[model samples]
Target: MQHTVIDGVDVYWAQGPAPMIATLTFGCGVRDESFRTLGVTHLIEHLAMSTLPRLHHEHNAMVDIEVTKFFATGKPAQLVDFIAAVCEALSDLPLSRIEKEAGVLTAEGSSGCHPTAGVLLARRYGIAGPGLAPWDGPGYDRIPAEAVTAHAARFFTRGNAVLTLTGPPPEGLRLPLPEGPRVVHDPVSPLSVDGPRWLAEDVPCVGMSLRGPSVSPVDAMGLQVLSHRLTEVARKEKGLSYGVDGDRASADSASTDRFVWVDAREGQEAEVASILWDTARELATFGPTAEELEHEVAGFREMIEDPRFVDGDLDEFARSVLLGEPYLSPAQWLEALAAVTPEQVAAALTESLRTALIVVPDGVRLELSDVDGKLVELGGCAAPEWQPQGKVFKPSLLARATSAAARGARLYLAPDGVALVDGGTRHFVRFADVVGVLARNGSRTVFGRSGCVVPVDSDLFKGIEPAIAAIDAQVDAGLVFPPSVFAGD
Candidate 1:
């Protein structure tokens, strides 16, 4: 893998063949942006893909808690043009334009109340805009546009970019070396303030951000497992969001933070808050089940091994450029997986749930209630607007998107590209860029952390290089970086 500086953006590059797949991940930190603008960055990404026409078909975008992503495919010839357009947008998307496209950031978590389906949802959440990103939407409204633009200028430094390429190599492909100073790491931590605080938003919601003493990777994984399980059990009541889960992260190399959130409809906000408080308190008193504990370890192991898990890394160079973790040979990953245990998960959960910092957002104007969950009448909030975009793609597209995700590609369509049979998968790449001529015998191999495999073979390997280069250029331009880079160290 090679790293370079282009127009002040850190660009990292790697090359390979046909069935090419590329991913551009933007890291703005989880709490870096605000809760109100939770989906703002996502809105920008989606708009760039659907609204912008020059990039053509196959380009796509989305936003996550810690990063935003852009992915594209089709003719490799158009890669550079697409990369330039995306970079231009990143540097200049006006906040006012976004605010108009998305609804007003009336209150913290107000956007969260919007139904999951809509243009507004994409616009309201995730990282984007300015100031140090915060846990809720206050930062979105508080940060000035100039500060946001300046933030963009500083964070999108040359060292922050990494380009990953998969499939065939294009002729005269240039893997540029680091040209300038390394992208300076952010000095201020991306984490929110520790302990509980009352967040009075349009909708009543309760949440707690816990500081776990253990920061070990194994413990981090354990905490995640625990969060998933606890969320599953707690959500048995139909009144709550069934899959309300917690997220565990190691901000620095030695400290961990876990956030658990729960919200209820209008009048039930206090009850929901009490339920969450009790749920957390119970972990220390009742403890996790032995089977649950065992499953946590097994689940974590499977997650680590799941072939379809695209925590980023296509040319395999992304792990080094973005994560900075010692790039372990494939063998080392297996050994590390083997060493994790169930006891560790229980301990992690025990430590995490001992104390609670609860937040209940009652529609009432900044009303603070006691620890016991009880309702306080509040005014109703108006429903927000919703909009949805992106193409209705076939599941097979996934086989081509991930390197560890390829099963096989077949020549059903002849010379240009082949139909990649990716049954039971969730990726979005075409088959022509993923399979190799040598693997044309029609066998199967799973890619990523999920056991997603394709079972057909196509002579698709021939034209994948240009596709890889095209996608590589976008990621290299600093449009995106994966969460795993910020998952731990």
Candidate 2:
């Protein structure tokens, strides 16, 4: 109900306390060109933040398939000026030719040659998705500047914005008047559905999902605590993921569903999958546990049991917001967390985690594929000379098309070429376009740009030692690693 126009967009600023929180929401239109330009909106987000020199410190940005969120924290006095700058930038949008070029370079610096970068490259080259989606589809070509300009004008309209502020609203923190033809649209919460899919390249890769019935909206307080409890349960369980957590009604809409995820080891795929399914079954079969039922009635008291609750800090407020118990008094958060029962916890989990998605890092391509499974015994691939910028080897796990020569031995191949090698203490290599014996030794571990361990040539051992060691270690680890577990014939 609280609303006003600011610089051609709608503004909804709320009053709270010491440190204010502002949420400025805007509708971003996807056209036949934008989607193809992966991270275009993300790029715009960075640019907008950079443009606002006032709040350069607390900058953060997030982009989902549909929405993009930007937030910055600062003193109340400077809030208006900070927000004003954002409004100005949005209102007087710029899409100059020089700016587009600069944006491309910046995007490249961040993406490098990673596969994800392919999206941006496609966008630059005018690739459109499936058809002419609101957002561009996938392609690998440069997009014309004129098309970029047209896309910007259609979206970024004043009628498509929701700006909210949570803090001590300044006397003059009113919405800025607009000088445009655009009108504000009524808020329409987005609909989210799950068609969860997962893919990981490892021996133990697997995926699982389940769904349960809805819970009482009144019991929202218990939902947050239940997530923490479930996280603890999964973390302690063997073969379970290191993290398993969920949120109840994270979005403002009534139709939205809660979700949780489990990241676990490969072999535990079936076990963990069954556990998740049974957990949901337990919910419908039995109501809340005694502790869970009690916690719900107490109204989430344990959450705010913090000693600093009396001081009224930002951290406390954030906790309250996350708990979905924001309307409750500080005492209520503390009260609810303590009183929740096992039954209530179970019920909440049943409601929210009924439909769960489980992702395991198992490399099994399919449950069934016995077409004489091909193995690219990588130890047999041809080795390349250590030239500058040298040669790049595909992991032994990859299906190589050629054979390799390692120590005068011809490695075997099963469709995938150089199968995974087991180099006990020694290392190994699966060099570029090469098969088994590609390089005799394992390359030195060099840190990639992302600080990940990537193999490189060493001064000694001619790289063969490392390759052999790598394959041996795989064998010793007892993992059903790659197809090339055995040496080439």
Candidate 3:
């Protein structure tokens, strides 16, 4: 692949066979959005491609944690036209269909499945910045055309984009992109908690996550080998899980997040968690075997050598470039992988364990008392007293409820906010902080801005419906999405 700069945008061109692919990527995604404007990038992406004519080609758009990409694959001429059209569309967005496109985004989000990266990142980084997913998107109803346009102006610019093609450059490829300064993603401030903590969710799977320094080729290869080893032991040898895999996400230029997970049967969650941790501990102690490393490296080399593996089209490279990571060729990457020793993998594993976070199937507890002191909780520091506006409700609970009684708990609802007063501490959630209120299984739960769930267990609190209604009233109608938004359709 050859690299050039056209009108301040980085361009990568490669020669390949028929059915060429052209992609225009911008450094704008979920990480660029604040909590109030969480899904604007996605909304802009959907709108930008809304007018593309689908003839003799296939076109699509994708918005992830850190980038938005529009791509088309077909004849070279069609691909060139698609790229030019998308750039023009971005330059002058058709906001006339804002509501229609938002509805489309809402339907898409409702049917979407949450990835493990979002779930774990929300825990590790909190919900404010790059860790915005795992929580419901900002209500599509609340987003206006002005907000979407403003977001597009900030991110969808020439300087912040890279156009990559896996075919000869098309003649008359006019990329009339918007002009703006290159966007530099600010470093995310991770939550203030020493981790390797444990969290149990309602899903029927067990996942363990670890964070470490920026990804090196060796660390990447080591994680691949370790994931394979765990999968072999957990899924093939013991028949304990249906699938086991590992994935990584970039937290910033300085750090990377690694996740290893296993999907098991309903009754086997604890066992799965135990085996996962045991495997992690063992791997951290001894690293992968030479045979395992060799096998994984071979697989890696094969993927790199695949005909479809266009270096410029790699999501990793796209993200890395935005984060200012040094570029390495496939051969250079292989050499680095070969140089990785078991001791180095072990050391990397050890560093990862220092701040690991284990997410287990809900209602299942894994014995992690040894790491209890390092556990992190969701939400920011306590809100000062002045934030509370008016008292809306104070529900009464049964006397035998020890969890609530012990803390002198009271549900305090206000016009602008809601607070759960436990002893002298107040976990106050403003209406703006609320993502949604869920009423299911005879219980009412309010999800906060940081994805923390404040549950009012039916057995404990009376007069809960009114409290829920009152809280719901304060939230904008458009922002109150359903609970299934989190559950993939």
> Of the candidates shown, which would achieve the greatest TM-score relative to the real structure?
3
Q: What TM-score goes with each of the models? A: 0.50, 0.49, 0.81
Candidate 3 residue lDDT tens string, 1-489: 677777677788776556788888887777777655667888788788887876666888887766788988888788778988888899999988877776677677631124555667777776655577655554664566788888988889887888878866777777788888778777877765566677765544688778776758767866687677778877898898888877656656677677777888778888877787777778878888888778877987897877777734354566666657566777778888888888888888787787877887667766653333434432233243434345533445344445555336566666666666655556666777775565566665666654455565555566667666766677765544343332443
Better of 2 and 3 by lDDT: 3
For model 3, what is the C-alpha lDDT against the true structure?
Answer: 0.70
Residue by residue across 1-489, what tens digits does model 1's lDDT show? 455544544445444334355555544433344322234444455334434665454776554433445666645655554555666566566556544343333222332222221111121221222211332332233334554554455444345555444434334333222233333233223212222333344322455555554235454555454456446655664446544645533233234345656545556666666556555545544555566555655765575465433323342345244534235433454455455565555565556543334545534333333344432322111112112222212224545565444444331222222223333322322232221111223322211111112222223244343333333332222222222111221
- TM value for model 3: 0.81
The number of clashing residue pairs in each candidate reads: 65, 113, 2
lDDT by residue for model 2 over 241-291, one digit each (tens)? Answer: 666544322222122334444455656655554454444445434644666
Q: Which stretch of 10 consecutive residues in model 2 shows the poorest summed lDDT?
A: 445-454
- Clash number for candidate 3: 2
What is the Cα-based lDDT of residue 446 in candidate 2?
Answer: 21
The C-alpha RMSD in Å for every predicted model, in order, reads 23.7, 15.6, 5.6
The local lDDT score (0 to 100) that residue 35 gets in candidate 3 is 57
The Cα local distance difference test for each model comes to 0.41, 0.37, 0.70
Global local distance difference test of model 1: 0.41
